[model samples]
Target: EESGSDSSQKQQSSQKSDSKGGSKGEGESENHEYISDAKKVMIEPIEAAQLDINHVVFLDPGKISITCPKDIGEHRSFIYDLETRQVVKLPDNTTVLKKLDNDDLFVMTKENTEYAILDGSSYTVKKAIMRPANVDNSLDISPDGKSIAYVTDEGLFVSDLDFQNPTRIVAAKREGKVFDMELPRFPKWFDANRIGYKVVGFKGVLYCGVVTRDGTVSKTYMEAQDATLYPLVNGDYLFRNDSGKGIGIIDANTGQKKFITESLLDKEGFAFDKNGKWVSYYMTNKEVTEENKWTGRFEVKGISSESKIMEFETEKPNAKPVENAVASPDGKFLLFTDMDMTGRRVLYKLEINAEQSQQSQKK
Candidate 1:
């Protein structure tokens, strides 16, 4: 009897072990099944939320970079970062695009004849190009950040960032025809490798083209019948006129086009939202005050028109003009240029709206 009882106990223990093993096997199988059956799609936001805007830093032609205090004075022409708090003093020259590559910067000398690359600590001479006696303009860096493109004497030229050897791309056609083009704006980057700029015709027609770092030219992106269009990055454009109405975009890959609304036409200016879904254009009406000062304010609109989503506004008729609007690559903050009473250009941060901007700010 004792032997039989012991044998029964052993058999019961073996059964319990098998049961637990079965459960373990089932749990493992269930985990695998859950992983395999699950599906996910990522959605990114477009228009962002508003935050307390402040000026972070300043860059100038003096080759000095300074962090700005909350109180700024008038007669200021510099640039800075909003988030990182980096500042660069532009040379007394035409040194735009304040912060150079996370730490350094570039400047055109006040004489507007020579250019330089500077860091906070020190700067190196980049190059000197022949300046025309009368034409006023600026310089631009290639999108890939490898070269510099600028116009001298109404002619266009490209050189490495280091300013080694210079090559002229555009030459004057006649006495009044600088490059024989009408729009007198500096070049802008399409990719790190190409630049888009306008060529003005004698007939007042604006012709836009893409030039490679190696100096190859593509056909005009768009031509206005009698108007001029400034190319914006990521397939959009700003139509500059007395009415300010001709903003549109053409896809770099597929050549698609879209135009802005008339409301956003006259005082409308655009900067890309942080997510790159929409470019925010501000619209304002002209007004005058009892103090005899010109007072004007504008509204902010994130355009996702291809997908039909518009969000946010400054909401007051007499707010302020939006200026120098730029976007962070991640599409989170639109760094805009604003002025205090002192007339200095300072950077302001506007957060992007996540849910709707991501959903609607589509191609």
Candidate 2:
């Protein structure tokens, strides 16, 4: 909870390149506020959590909902209010489909079989959304929250929030485009009128496709031999960054690649700020062997200018490496997921210096 210099586990170094990324001088941190301290959130006390937290959705700046995978102690989701330090179960024992920030409406699901739209403020069921019987991670609500898009055994369909008037958008029988329940890249609503999906073809090839409300796929992004496409919030994507080596943003609309950093090794923890201005990922120079595979240098860089904002290496002896990172909504703090020796995932919040964060917020 204390945010100050924790030099013991945080490494701030001089001008050098560890791998192919993060070229910063030793004095670089004097101008920028790097990581300070980290403390585990008090969520472990809740026994149902089973010492694991994942799939976090920000209900607002003050509240968040988290859910662990099915393999956890019990399949359930809980909402944690940061200000009050209270946890409550979500209605329908559902998983949040989208972040409910200020917006009063969002979709959540129960065991992937049923869907419901709820009012964020009251947490009351607003509409009965539909889900494909056999699908997981199959539904995405439109940006406007008026429509829901989902994938089924037959095809992809769009319907009103009430689960009625479903219009088939893509037919698997005719287009050979099917949504894979096993993959994390579920159906996504990229804009007000379109849903994005990825089609895995023969030999592990991928096609990043965007279908408009009228079901048109033109000039889709066909992937290179081994590249996996990750969708960006704006329908652009992490086209070249999937390999954990070259990190970048590819404009699927124009096919322009914006290289953020090259030679990063931690694909497990790649993230962009809410505005897509800053990027964070892990990098390493030494060979990843059994002994030191879980330690490396983490960096945050400006996307367009390719400038290094800050870098630090985390130290966790005999524990797992940081697997995920999220920038706070105000661009002032970073939230990370680390682990203790017992393999319990812990959430840590690190804040930048007040001056640096205040300036960022003004931007």
Candidate 3:
């Protein structure tokens, strides 16, 4: 009886071990499947040796316009045809500002005092208008191409395409109780009848709001202490906080604000995809040394907090850090200006591909 009991005990122990091993194997298989599904996409770099392009604007899927600086302190803008890989120069001394929704180009003189609407195909000036006095280069043409919105010392103004019958959308003021002084900057068109702008108030408080073409300001949509307010095609606004903590979006109709992230570092560059689904921002990794000193690695995170799609390490020796990284309208490419290891400023285009669709969760 003792010998039979020993055999049974040994068999039971063996069976338990086999069961545990099978469970472990299944766990590892699940882990491998998850990792493979969540793998990041790669970024492919494109080199441009023939053209000295600085700024780029996508005219369409197959064509892009670039602004190259001339030796005379003016810009020579041109259209680059991707299929043919050819660069065709536009008008000289003209800096392309905003590409209107109608596919026309809004261009300004290097002096910023003269503005014109140019035909994209012919590269000819369709309408020329003299900018107002004391007005800076901050301007936005309406979507329909019939009006222009700009900022002046007196206030934010909108005028007809011909510069006739200019109307003040908002007036600058000085208030001792709330703010010492308040002025508008960088007026943009929200729609056909509304304009958006950033208001700099006392103590460097920034506010963003939308006002009607007839000067009716929306009280519910004003955001204070915001850095920059970008009008989106979906009628929403994307803004960064004054502390630069993170970026968020404000719904145009609902007036609800949702933050995307809060781990942003000061002066770190960020850009949103055209559809506002994905954001690419710079992040730094710090290392502590034996001497109690800290070192940082400049990296780029092409994701939000909840999901990560791709990451880039820009910590190479002698490679200047990137700035002003922007996503293409189609969200397929990222463009940025950076200095190479040779210390020459160059524009780079990065192709973005992800395994899964990038969709942001609305909280």
Best by TM-score: 3
Q: Give the per-residue lDDT of model 2 (tens digit) for 1-363.
A: 112443322333322222213442321111111233434556633444464666666666666677655553345667777667787766535777666334654655555666776776676787776564554456777876777777666566778766578887666533434443212134677667767665544434355566786676534555422344555555566644444556777777676665566566655556665455666676644466556654445666666556556556545454344665666665565666665435666565654433222111100
Worst 10 residues of 1 by lDDT: 38-47
Point to the candidate with the largest lDDT.
Answer: 3
TM-score for each candidate, following the candidate numbering: 0.55, 0.69, 0.72
Worst 10 residues of 3 by lDDT: 26-35
Pairs that collide, model 2: 14-25, 14-26, 15-24, 15-25, 15-26
Off by over 4 Å in 3: 1-51, 175-179, 217-224, 233-235, 253-256, 265-269, 284-305, 316-318, 354-363
Give the Å error, residue 329, model 1.
2.7
Find the 10 residues in a row with the least total lDDT in model 2. Answer: 354-363
RMSD of 3: 13.0
Ranking by TM-score: 3, 2, 1
User: Per-residue lDDT for 98-196 in model 1, tens only?
Assistant: 455544555545445555555535444454444445434566765434577776554667777644477766554456545454543456665566666
Assess the local accuracy of residue 40 in candidate 3 as a C-alpha lDDT between 0 and 100. Answer: 16
Question: Cα-based RMSD of the predictions, in order?
Answer: 19.6, 9.1, 13.0
